[model samples]
Target chain A: MDLHLSERHLRFRDELRAWLEKNVVRPWREELRDPTASEDSLIELRRAWQKKLHAGGYLGLDWPKEWGGRGATAVEKSIFEAELVRADAPPILNFLGLSLLGPALIHHGSEEQRRRFIPPMLSADEIWCQGFSEPGAGSDLASLKTAARLEGDEFVVNGQKVWTTYGPWADWIFVLARTDAKNRYGGISFILVELRTPGVTVRPLRQITGESEFGEVFFEDARVPRANLVGQIGEGWKIAMTVLAYERGATALAYSTRYSRDLAALAHACREVGRTGPAVREKLARLVVENEVMRANGVRMLANLADGKIPGPEASMEKLFWSEFDKRFRDTAIDLLGPGGLLLRSCSEARPEVDWAREFLWSRAETIFSGSSEVQRNILAKRALSLPQEG
Target chain B: MRFELSDDQRLLRDSARDFLAAEFPLEETQRVVEHDPRGFDPAAWARLGEMGYLGLTLPAEVGGQQLGAVELAIVLEEMGRACVPGPYLDVALAAALLAAAGGRERLLAEIASGKAIVTIARQDAAFAGEAPCGIETANGKLRGRKYFVPFAAEAQALLVTTPGGVYRTDAPFAVTPLPTLDPTQRFARVDFDHVAERMAAADVVAGLEPLAAAAAAAMLLGVMSRAFEITLDYVKTRQAFGRPIGSFQALQHRLADALLRVESTRSAVYRAAWCLDNADPDAALAAASAKAYAGDAARLVCGESIQMHGGIGFTWELGLHFFLKRAKTLESHYGSTEVQLERALAAAGL
Candidate 1:
């Protein structure tokens, strides 16, 4: 069982590392700690970074080469993520478009749709937000009440999508709206609606972290062209399921890298504060052990991917692990850091290494979003374990 | 980069599993635990040596297969699944220490041929929170006591640890059995008064801790996984409230969490074994992490197996308690989770 990177993969990593070293002028932490940086300015910074990555031919890393990709394997994609974390580079502004919508359109969208959408999506000219979750249809996404009726040349849509991450700045929303009201799963249609359409509205919602990173989108009889529909009318659920599967890439490596950096920072902070007692040291050591295990898990996942193994229901285990561990790590950081840990990033007394307060609050949303911990557990029980369904 | 066992390793695992299943089923283990003074069947122990299981990691010069840690982990994991009764890990480690000291070829051959039994006697205390190194050398003879020496009553010789070095002490008298949660395990406190010959420096066995931790964690992985599987099967067939109890969301979610721990332990155990086999830079930290993680994971999975089984789980006749008890013993020994945590921290330079 070999875990060493192949020569080709090593070359890919070295080249990417060199590119990052040359291009990244300011690490993301420095940008976030800038007192004058506003939300819009930070987003512009990320957009600029995305453009740089696209120019470097690093975007859509594992996608087919015909669509501006490097035609890399999953191992390369995992290494790209880990390198980004190690460099502390700013996250791309159009991640939803690149990760979710790009795969969906490449696989299920009509040729015309791909031609119109893929380029701008890669270039960060048009940002995308998911319109799948709503106030009434979160864990039970198929129960969505969003309706879309076909008119002469357009589909009239009416829906309210909540927890719309990036909706505040996105130019488009790919929605799952009901076209046949009687059928639960098959009636759903995947439609892309412009944010500036006549009756569409986007209102930012303040999160517990005191940021408007996500918002709610309202659709009041918005007319989207029939050409915006992806695939057949009744195939939205199938397409959406496949799109979610794309999110299950080897993310553990990136998560562990980022966490390790923050953990080292926390350890330094503890030393600076002279909190090196046995109890505190034990807590820090446990976190260290846990993070190392997470790294092992990530390495195993990458090795399996390289071994030509398809990820199955075990992806839920990864999701549950990182998300839950985030909460524990953040909670321990706050406990060890004392009251100073709760200070906002703008506060002068706050730790500059990590936005501890923001992460502490943001970790709450991680378990709730994507797929909630409960949903992941259900997936493991029903799919992986093959347990009997509830009567 | 591949994470799976190679073809030869897979063959070893399959053969080990088949042999252990046939020769050391839970019923036979139960019989040994109940009546065998040696804590293992003599015939079965001889079979293991004949099958080359005893010398899995020893060099060919000593009549061994000269395999690596991954192969040892595979065999030990299967033994754990079968709840095989013996001092397999103890004897293998003792033999390795002797091999590393660069002498005693005859004893090594005897060990590989199942003609003799030897195990390390290292523990200096009978309980936690006590000062260590009570055992020392005096008058060219080993003195003081060593606690938790595996199979001390049955071992023909004991490699006793002293303040200065490790000494080979032949055994004839003075062994007090210290039985606890696991009946299949035979630990003892040995009053070492025999004339001793210093075998090697104290640090000669420095490399053994990680190997021991990784191998023990592999055994824990097997124990928890088998317990989980047994519980899963039980819930699928056992009825409650007019339907299978596994259908309830409460049981389902808990079982899901249990599965998470079991699988995570598997990943950690194999990764540690691989790192050690390859002599990778991360070997120490990976082995420590695997042991620490597996200790807690085995506790949860084995405890949940009993909880899910309701009443029969607690009964001795059902044999679930044996797994739970064995898991506890494995957790506290072979470098306990607390010790591994500290080792991991040092390895990571935290």
Candidate 2:
């Protein structure tokens, strides 16, 4: 089977590259790297950048034009991501809403919900956070104890969502709450709530990276309009599943592209340093091969998704490999850099503060955040290997 | 772009599965492993020949089916599933090498008819120096010792790789059987002492190295896939804690990972095979990655399959040992994981 892109796709890629080169500038890059940048500044910059993308018809390229998208093919989407990484543009702050929740709402949400949410998401008028993981329910998400009770025309929600990235800045949150507690999966419902609602509190949690990029969102008697409920009653579990599929499915593209670029840069830097020995070179080569494998796997996954394949449990393999590889690659970069790699972003002597050190620290959560590597291994064992299940 | 198997490939797989099941069942394999010249049934080889599998991927002009690598891979996978006791991989690789070398019309014809057993001898322990330590060629005479040559005792023609080039020998070369981890795929140590033979090609050594590695990778894919299926079947029916173990999340996740590894390696091996067939520039890299990934995956899955099966898996009577042995042997056959990694790195220009 041919792995090369078609002529038309190549042309499209060139066009996208040209566009990104012209549009994506150093200001956006500078804004993203500014660790002490105010949350409002980051939010404003993200909104402005997203608005520019929308105006340029790049945002929501995979969605229908009627829904404020260019309706581009998956290949085009991959090209866009690759070019975006190459351009070193600002990171998308509304990834949860744009990639995961927005897609789920498009598929499972009511017509009104779609009309209300999709446009705002595309325009960056609204930012969203996922309310899936809880204290006791991370990988075992169905065991979530969040509750939402129907009351007249609204639902009173009360629950705590931990590890909610950018929760403090989100304008809305799509939550999976237990509406019918008798059945685990069947009892759940997906609903959207405005973050400005009364009794809703968001407390930013300090991470090991010393950044408050994520937060704990607590809802106490918070009211959500009944119209915000996605799909049928007690169908939140299905909606959540759909969102998770999108999340896991989209992972191969974004993660691989970013890491591939990072890997290339790291290799260049190591060569420039000229102090890396044969062992370091061998380690670097291994990471390169792993990166290539991940890229191939990612391309295959994307092709399968484009062909309407659900990817099912195989996504776990991609997740496991990508996260683990990220950590290892970053660690290898650090080791190769030696003392120079230890320099923090705030340190003047730090060898290009944005190089391997920041990456090493950031990669700490790669496995832990997106369902720990342990959980991923469990998925691979049970779903892929068909092994005898442990009691 | 098209990864799906063709109709011919599908039929090849089905027919291979049916033939192996009927002719070379596990009982027959056990018998062959216990008391055959090379631990493979001759009758089974004849049956495979009669079914046109011997020359499944050879050209029609060469007295063969002329199918593609995908079809060959399908058949190989079935053989793996059955844990079929034969020298299929060795013969197939020899045929491919002969085809690439371009002057072996007679041998190819004989192999297509399943009348000849051939294997490539390329594994040299000493990889450095002007010439490898295992095999040497000087003035058309080949000498040196070849280690762990699969089915070497039973091979009618030995395809020996030397620093000078690849040479084919039908004459009596010293062959000593070596006790191997996987008896089903028997091995032997051979000492070629100035054996007179025709040098196949000047660049045959360089050209055939990757092909042999790719074939070994494909064979391992077959083994791992079958082992996974067997493990899955056992896990499904074998009860633990009052329910089928397959129902448990822990086992399911592990099995899923195994399936992913197997499937990914399957894809990689097939891609490598395709690269060989098409003579793609990326053939070497693809072959290296395929071998490296498949070797690791096979070892891991095989070990886990035994662990998941509990006591029965570790027993010889249960037959899990057969595949485990084969997996371990295959991992070190073409190239060790470390060697493959080095090759992969060089191929990637790292």
Each prediction's RMSD to truth: 1.2, 3.5
Question: Candidate 1's residue-wise lDDT over B1-350, tens digit each?
Answer: 98889999999999999999899888888888899888898888999999999988888888899998888888888878887888888897898789888889888988998878999998888777788748778888888988899999889888887769889988684999998889988899888778999998888867778898899999998899889999999999999999999999999999999998888888888888899988999999999999999999988999999999998999888888878988999999888888898898788878
Highest lDDT: give the candidate number.
Answer: 1
Runs of candidate 1 exceeding 4 Å displacement? none
Give the interface RMSD of each candidate. 0.9, 3.4
Best candidate per TM-score, number? 1
Spell out the clash pairs found in candidate 1: none
lDDT of all the models against the reference?
Answer: 0.90, 0.77
Reference contacts preserved by each model: 0.81, 0.31
Instruction: State the displacement of the C-alpha of residue B336, model 2, in Å, after optimal TM-score superposition.
Output: 2.2
TM-score of chain A of each: 0.99, 0.93
